[model samples]
Structures are given as C-alpha cells and as structure tokens.
Target: MLDLRSQAAATRRAADRVGGLTHHLTLAAAATLESVARSQLRKAQVDPVLELASNASTAEINEARRRRSVRRGQDVYLPSWREAAVGLPNLFLRSALFSVCSAREVLVDETIATQGDTVITMTGVQLWNYDRRMFAACLNYYRDDRPLSSSAEHPWVKVSLWQLAQDLKVSYGANVHKAMRESLIRLNAAHLRIRVKRQDVPMPRLIDVAFDDGYLGRDTPAPLLRGSDTVAFRVLDSMANLFGPSDWSAISDTALHERSGLSSWLTGYYSTHAGPFKLAVAALHQYSGSICELREFRRRLKNALLALEGEDIPTDCRIASPEISLLL
Candidate 1:
C-alpha cells in the first residue's frame, strides 16, 4: 500500500510540472503574436502627407486597399502634369487609324497588322493629328492621382473647353471652341474591331463616347463659350483597359504638340519602341495612312525623319532600290 501511494504522488508531481510548462509556452506564443501584430499595424499606417495630398476619405482609403489586395496586377495611372507626358495605347500608335493628313471626312474598312497574327479592323471617319492631340488632352484630365472607384463601363471627366484648348496649346476663342467640339464628336464616331487569333479575343470599339454639353438634352443647342463652360467626356471600358501597364506608352507632350503631320505621328510611333529598329518604308507608308503616292511619301518621310532627329529622336533612312527601310 505504501509503495503504491508513493508512486501516485510522483505521478501527480510530474503532471503538475507538465501543466506549468504548457502554461508558459501558451503565454509565450501569445506575446509573440501580439508583437507581430503590432509591427504589421505600424507598417500599414498611412502617411499623413500622402493622405492630405490625395485628399481621400478614410473609407476611400480602405476601399482602395481592398481593391489593391483583390486585383491581380498594379493599376497604371497617368502623370499629374500635362507637360510631363501622357499615356497612349500602343495599338493606337502602331495602327493607321489616325490618318496622317488634313482633317477630312473618310470611310474606311481595312485590316492592319499588329502583334503576331493579330489584326485590327478599323472603320470610321479618318482621324487627324489634331484630333490625336485633343484625345491626349482629355486623358490628361482623367489623371488617376487619387484612388478613384469608377464604373467599369465608362470612366469620365468634366473639364471646360478653354482648359482643353490651353492643354492643346491653342488659342481659346468662339471659333476654336466650336472646332474642338466637332473634333470630340469625330473621335466618338470612330470604331475599332480587334481580332486576336492567338488569344481568341475580340473587342468591339476603341472609345465609345462623345462630349455632353450641359444644355444639350432639352432640345436646345448650347451656345459657343468664351470659357468656363464644362463638358463631360467619357471613355469606354475597352479604351480604359488599354491604359494598363503593358499596353500603353508615355509620349512626350512637348514633342507631340510641336510637330505636325508625319512628324507628329512619328513621335507617338517611336515612343512605343525602346530602341531603333528597321522597318520597310512601304510598310511605314501604309501604316501612316498617308494618301500620298509611295514615291512622294518617301521624300516626305525623309524630311519627317530629319525633323524627328531635331526633336531628339534618332533615325537612319536607307534608300536602297529594292526596298527602302528606316532604323527608327
């Protein structure tokens, strides 16, 4: 009986020691967790200066964080300043949708090569370099400086006609305002049909909208403005999708606005490429959407290439008989 009682007492002592060790381990684990949580909280804290600059509400900040966590990739945002540069889709730059000619009404239905076996069928009024500038200015106003949760169907901006003209470096007058309004209408009328065979993706239109002058809905025409009259410009989801990190290039605003005709087009085209590459002059001519004869285009191309060089864009034009090519 005595031996059995001694053994039982030893067992109880062992169990007590085990319980004490377990309690210490649990407390240690809880302390470590608290420390880690505090560290994370500090790291997640928002900078007050950045918060002020963005002018975002607390709910907006939380929503942006949630969206960023859920999205697969980072969002591409435009620069804050107009003079810095603007993000333009590579597909727009590489194709002949914007014709390198004077503003004229056009009806086109043609297939243009882009990526491997990917062709874009464009059908709309022939857009000019001037229109391209106007489109860029609109994008400038749609800068994503703050976390903007907009409808995926259409993201829009409201800016005065005078502001747009200033961004385009044009004198804002009654006549200029009328012309700008017409240009936006033309841009909205254009359409692009992208057929991607490799990925089996088909897209409908490039940009699917026009401007809305405040007084247009009541069956009354809005008068031409001196300034300060706002117009709503909306961009389609597909068009907005092109602004993704991989699909667009930052084009120099100064270079684009300074040059005109083929030179202006070249500014955008070369901006898409990182370095110079050889391309046939014939292909360039077709891509430029120039109505000039091939021979005449070659002459103009040479001059345009020189002008681009002056704008700090390096180029080499090889005038060989069999085929003319450019290292742009």
Candidate 2:
C-alpha cells in the first residue's frame, strides 16, 4: 500500500509540473499573438488598403474616401482618413517566420565538423547561375559566405593554375574581358567532351566541368554564375521557388519544410540524440575503468538519449543499458 501511494504521488507531481509548463507556454504564446496584433494595428493606421486600426473593411475604406469634404464657396470642411496598409501583415508574418529560423538549435556532425568550427548555415536555398566566364555576372545571387575551395582530380598532364593564368595573360594581352570571352568560346567547342563513369559502368557523352572557387576563405560571397565549361544557363533561388520567385507564394508549409534543409536537420538531430550522448561518453572515461569500462560507458550514453536510460534497456547500440539516457 505504501509503494502504491508513493507511485501515485510521483505520478501526480509529474502531471502537475507538466500542467504548469503547458500553462506558461500558452500564456507566452498569447502574449506574442497580442503583440503582433498591436504592431499590425499600428501599421494599419497609415496603409490605404489595410483595414484601419478600427477594423474597418473595404466598404469602410470606400465610405471614408467618399466622405471626404471639400471647400464650397466660403464654407470649408475636412474628414480624417485612417491608415490601411496591405503589405504590413505579410511583413509581420515574415518576421515571425525568421524568429522560428533563429530559434532552431545548431546541429553538426562531429566526424565532419569540429567543435567551434564554422559550418554553413542552410537557412534557405542557394541559387546558382551558369556564367563562370565573369564572376560578377552572377551578382543577383550573391549572399554573405566565405568562399570554399572546390576541386576535382585531373589526369597526368596537370594544368597548373599559374600556367593557365599565364597562358591567358599572354594570349589576351591586356584585355581580360576578351580573354575570358575566348576561353568560354573554347569550352563551348563540341570536341572538348568528357565521359563520366559511375559504379564502374561507362556513361555516354558526359561533361566533366569541375568548378573551383575562392569564396570559402574569403569573407565575401562568390559569384553564383560560376558554372563550368558545360554550363550554359542557370539561376539560383529558394528551392521553394523552383518554378520561379513568383510561384513561391503557392508553396505550402509542408512543402517548404521538405524543400528547406531545416526540418530534416531537426528530425535527424532529435532521433539521433547525438550532442548529449557525446557529452555522456566523455564523462564515463573519468572514473571507474572495468565496471565502468569504455564499452559500458558508451552503452550508458546511448540509453540516456532514448529517454529510457534507466527505464528501458536498448538492445542494439554502443551501450545496452537504459540508465545512460537519464541526462546523468
């Protein structure tokens, strides 16, 4: 009877704590909504099409416009016009959307990324255009990012960068523009084609134009139109606007999440429970060696992340015990 009562009491406490959190979260959400409404109402005061802060609709706007008074002979009268702006609501929503973006936790693969190392944040889709001849030609797609080196392996006769640049210099003399134009022309020639092999299978007529850029180390954006010899035309934009920027409005929430890398990043992070587990493994190495051996320590780390660290033992993982997942 005592054990039953203790369990019941523990359950009640958990329930109460959860209830408190829910209430606080709801209140916070309500406050945020109210704030947004107030901001929109303030903005509506000046916008002609937006419903006035008074919540007046299109009819009200027409009536207000019609009611405007003009001076007749010596008599003069005026009507006060309220603000109504259509674009303000959209601006508010976009601000909210970006808030969501900023709230997401940053996740990184430790194997590929080091702690404190800078990694590319894929907040949105990157657009690229085909125009490597002159980097400046792709200005429309420029965004702030350090240039990264992109390389590809070549055959026996290595074309050193210095040699290529020197050859271009001598051939084009002082006219850099003309040299670039002629180089692009040479790339366009059909005779310069490559064959790509995939899975040891030969593919017909493949264009092996590798792109290299200096933007990864530089604190400025690389030109988006830096396509290689095979690229003819291209443009970059949010994958959500694959059809075009004008079509972006039609993209649904579900579609946006899938197209954007953000959702995938979250789902992967949570299911994997990578960050916490890593910290746990590091902790185990500090104390007991045998009973708390490295293998056993890893088991504890894995179990903890699944929310079953002490409750349910995991069958397949670095650690088999459930006790590891308890955030210990």
Candidate 3:
C-alpha cells in the first residue's frame, strides 16, 4: 500500500511539471507571434494621405469630417511638410499664361504653345510674373484657411487685401492696395484653354480652364478698394482642379520671393521639371512672352541664370553661333 501511494505521488508531480512546461511553451509561441507582427508593422510603408489625416488637430479632423459629408470626398488638404511651399499647376508654369513681361494687352485665344497634338491658348488681359506671385499668395491663404472643399462645380475663398499685401512682403498702403486690386481683377478676368487631339479620336477634346470668376466685396462694390475689407474670390472649378494631386508642383516660397521678374519665372519653370535639359534661348523667349529683342533677351537670360545660381540652383549656359541654350 505504501509503495502504491508513493508511486501515485510521483506520477502527480511529473504531471504537474508537464503542465507547467506546456504553459511556458504556449507563452513562448505567443511572444514570437507578437514580435513578428511588430516587425511587419515597422517594415510597412505608411500611406501619406492617411498619415496626414491622422496628424490633424481635433478641430481640423472634425471639420474635415463635416466637410466630407457636405462635399462628398472633396478634401483639399496638404501635408505639413509642404507648408513652406506653394502648389502651382505644371501647365501654368510650363506655358506663357503668366508672361515674363508686364504688358497689359488683351489676348484673344492667343496660342501659347503646341505640344504634339495639344494646343494651349489664353484670353483676357496679359498676366505677368507679379500676377503669378499674387496667385501663389492667394493659394497659400486658401490652404491656410482650410475652407470647405468645393467641387469642380463651385470653389471660392473670402480673403483680405491687407493680408495679401503682407503675404507678398509689401507694405499695406494706398498704392499697394491699388496694385492688389488690379492683380485680383486680372486673375479673375484671365481664361485659358487646352485642346488635345488623339489619333484614335475624330475630334479634339477641350479641357476646362476658367481660372477665376472675379472678386465680390462684402460691404463695398466689386474689387474692393479698402485694404481691410474682405473680398470673395471665386476660384473656378478648373482652377481648383489644377491643385489636384498629380497636376501640381510644390514651389519653394523662399526661392520664389527672393527673385523677381524673369528670374522668378525661371525659378517656377524649373521647379516643375525633375530632370531639366538644354532648352534653346529662342524657345524660352517664345515661352516667356518677353517683349525684348532677341539680343536684349540674351543679356537678361544670362543675368537670370546667374540669379538662379545665387539661389543655389545650378545652371549651364551653352553659347554657340546662331544658337544659345541653357541647362538647369
């Protein structure tokens, strides 16, 4: 009987030891699976759009949610890293929509360029490099305000003229207010058209290109004169589409503000190209809509190239008889 009891006790001890061993094995297996899951998460590529949405403030998130329901997926938001940059359309930068010169001539279906089967045309008062700068400032404000995203049907922003002058790095005064008013009018008045022909298609398709519809003042009449007054700037659906994810380039505000006139235009032009090649001076002159003679433009081009280099942009000007080209 004593031997039987001792054997039974030994068996129970061994069973307990086995149970404990099984428990430890289970824990080890669970730990291994958890570690693998963590490693996989670390290796995964995070979606930038989702990350941007996640990092927004609570108010912004709520506002986005509210707007999402109202606009149905029209979320116009930029990543935090792009705060120092201004987003502009590649088509606008590539073409002479904003001419390098400050000529106020009215253009009616003026052909800007022809790329293969695509022909770009512009109408209304000529836009200059300064107008480009003002447009940039307006875009910056629109982004900052985080207004309710509007569809290609309707898009607008209510802005202050005084604040716009500050954005342009100019003093807020009568002259500055007058200039801002004129720029706003010009941007609203300008119209662009891009016609593309496909070999398989019989007719060319025209892309939508109403840039801006003009400004409406709150208390005063259209094109408000008071620097402190607010104006409703209508950004057409076509213009808003230019700010779409694939169509725009982020231009450095510092580089753009530091330069003016032709140099500034060059800065924006090159920002759109990832690998810039040698471009003929004649081509650039036509693209810039410069009123200067070819010889005079050559001198200005050299200076513009130097100015770009000063802003840490490398350039090589190739001068040959009967032809001049530049590589950036």
Candidate 4:
C-alpha cells in the first residue's frame, strides 16, 4: 500500500509539472501574438501598395506606368481596407460537416438521427471552402493594413468573384459562377448551434448563430462589383469577432488550393506544431476530410504522407505502415 501510494504521488507530481509547463508555454505564445499584433498595426501606417509596386519587376512596372504614370512613392493599386474575417468554432474546425457538397441537410450530431430545427446542419462544401478562403484573405488584408472605406452596409470586407476564384486557384467558368452563387445562398442560409464540454459540466452551450449577408447583388453578378468585373461579396457583421484577438493559424493559400483534402489536413496538422506529433490513425481519419473506409483511409493517408515528403514532412518521418509516427 505504501509503495502504491508513493507511485501515485510521483505520477501526480509529474502531471503537475506538465500542467505548469503547458501554462507557461501558453503565456509565452500569447505574449508573442500580442507583439506581432502591435508590429502589424505599426506597419499599417505606411502605404502597402508602394511596397508592392517597388518590388514589382521592371516589365510589370512598365505595364503599370503605361496604364497610369507610375511615380516613385505614389500608390499604384488601391489597398483593400475591408477586413472579411470569419471566426470558426472548435466544433466547426474538428467535426462539422460543412464540406458536404450536396444540398441535402447534413446531420451534425452523432446521437441524433433526424435533424430538426434545433439540430445543426451545414449547407454545402462550397461554403466550407469559402469560409477558409475568406478567412485567409481577411488575414492578408489585416496584415497588409488596407485602408478602410466609408461603406456601411458592405463594411467587413468586399471581394469580387473573380478575385475569389484567383485566390482559390481555380479557372473561372460557368460552373464556377454557379457554385459561387449557390455557395453565397447556402452560407447566408446556414444556421448553427454549438455545444461544448466544460470541466464544470458535461456539456455547455456555446453560441447559436446564423451566417448572413453573403452577396452584394440581385440574382446575378453586378456590372461592376467593387470596381471589378465579378460578383461582390462581404463578410457578415456577426462573424466579425473571428478576427479579434484569438487563436489563429497561418494556412498556406498555395497548399489549400493545390493539395487534396487529406493532404490539406496533413498540412494543417503540421502547421499547428513545429515538430513531431504522435496521433492515432483513427484520430487522423476522423480529422481528415476524406470520408472513406479503414482500408481506403490507410491508402489515402499513406499517399498524403508520401506527397508531403519533399515539402514540409521530413524524409525521416516516412510512414511504412498504418501504425507509424510522423514528424514535420
């Protein structure tokens, strides 16, 4: 009994040490983020367009000069002050079925069979992708310190469909237009109620919200939305808090546009950490956007790991089988 008690005491001490370390790390990270925020705000005082134009190639400068006489320190392109940020809940990031492309009501709750008005449901995949796209663009705009305009109704951030397509790295076509239109409708229509587990209780209700004001047009693309030949869209005021001082991760727009769903998941997983992480295959499968059987999951995950070899994942971090460790 004495020996058992000593062992238990040792375990408790170790856990306490780990907890203290975690707390310290969290404080350090918070301090770093605060410093970054201050620096970004300071940098915002300068005209970012001049920085871009200064770095442009001679040919590019000549083209801009031909269009409109380019001055040494004058702004070439107007900086977008519109901040279109979306704060996604942990539930939405981890397990929400926002990427189901079909129009059918996606069942979010595992225990519940039929989705009633109370049960959360995602509209489609386009909205899911749009959420990430807009979030990234908003972060970029914030980082660039774009000048805010006097538009009240379209306040958060205004982006044209063509620019959005370019950001998404997809060629604009009829299908793209249709998808954009339908996604705007679905995003505006989506209603969600999130429930989270707390130490005080088994489950605590977080927030009940809906996405609103998706597009800036009537039925079709406006002649010139935001001075561009594409449909204009704005971030909802409700989603504005997502841009506040919160946990944010830097996601590569290139990876997001180029990689497969599973590859993208791996990239995100790696971005969350600076070193190796040991996660179970089951957990990875759950987090991966790939909805497939165990065999198929293994196959795809292996391919994703393989694809990451030359990029972020170290060559030594190769996975020979299902039960393997990954280091990025």
Off by over 4 Å in 1: 1-83, 112-116, 146-155, 200-224, 311-328
lDDT scores in order: 0.59, 0.26, 0.58, 0.42
Decreasing lDDT order of the candidates: 1, 3, 4, 2
Candidate topping lDDT: 1
TM-score, per-candidate, Cα-based: 0.63, 0.15, 0.61, 0.49
Model 4 C-alpha lDDT per residue in residues 1-328, reported as the tens digit of each score: 3343455445555455566677566555555555665566556443212333446675664443222223233322221222332223223344423331223444333322111122333333323445444444433543332322223433454555666666566766545655555555555444443222211111211111122323344554543233243443333322322212222234555544555466655554555444555765666665544457867777777777776765454432323232334421
lDDT tens digits by residue: candidate 1, 1-328? 3343455445555455566777566555555555665566666543211222245454553444322211212232332323467767677787776668775766676665443355777677777888888788777654544322235543456778788888888888766777787677778776677644223223454333445454343334446354777676655433443433345677777656777888788778766766665787877887777888998998998777655555344332111222224332
- Write model 2 residue lDDT over 1-328, tens digit each, in one string: 3343455445555455566677566555555555665565565433211123344453553444232322222222122222210001111111111221222222221111111211212222111111121221211111111111112321212232233333222232223323343333322221211111111111111112233332232233334212221223221111101111111111122222222222212222223232333344443333111135566545543434443222332221223233434534
User: Candidate 1 at 246: error in angstroms?
Assistant: 3.7
Error of 4 at 31 (Å): 34
**Model 4: lowest-lDDT 10 consecutive positions:** 198-207
Q: How big is the positional error of residue 71 in model 4, measured in Å on the Cα after superposition?
A: 36
Clashing residue pairs in candidate 4, if any? 87-242
Ordered from best to worst TM-score, the candidate numbers read: 1, 3, 4, 2
RMSD of each: 16.6, 24.6, 18.0, 14.5
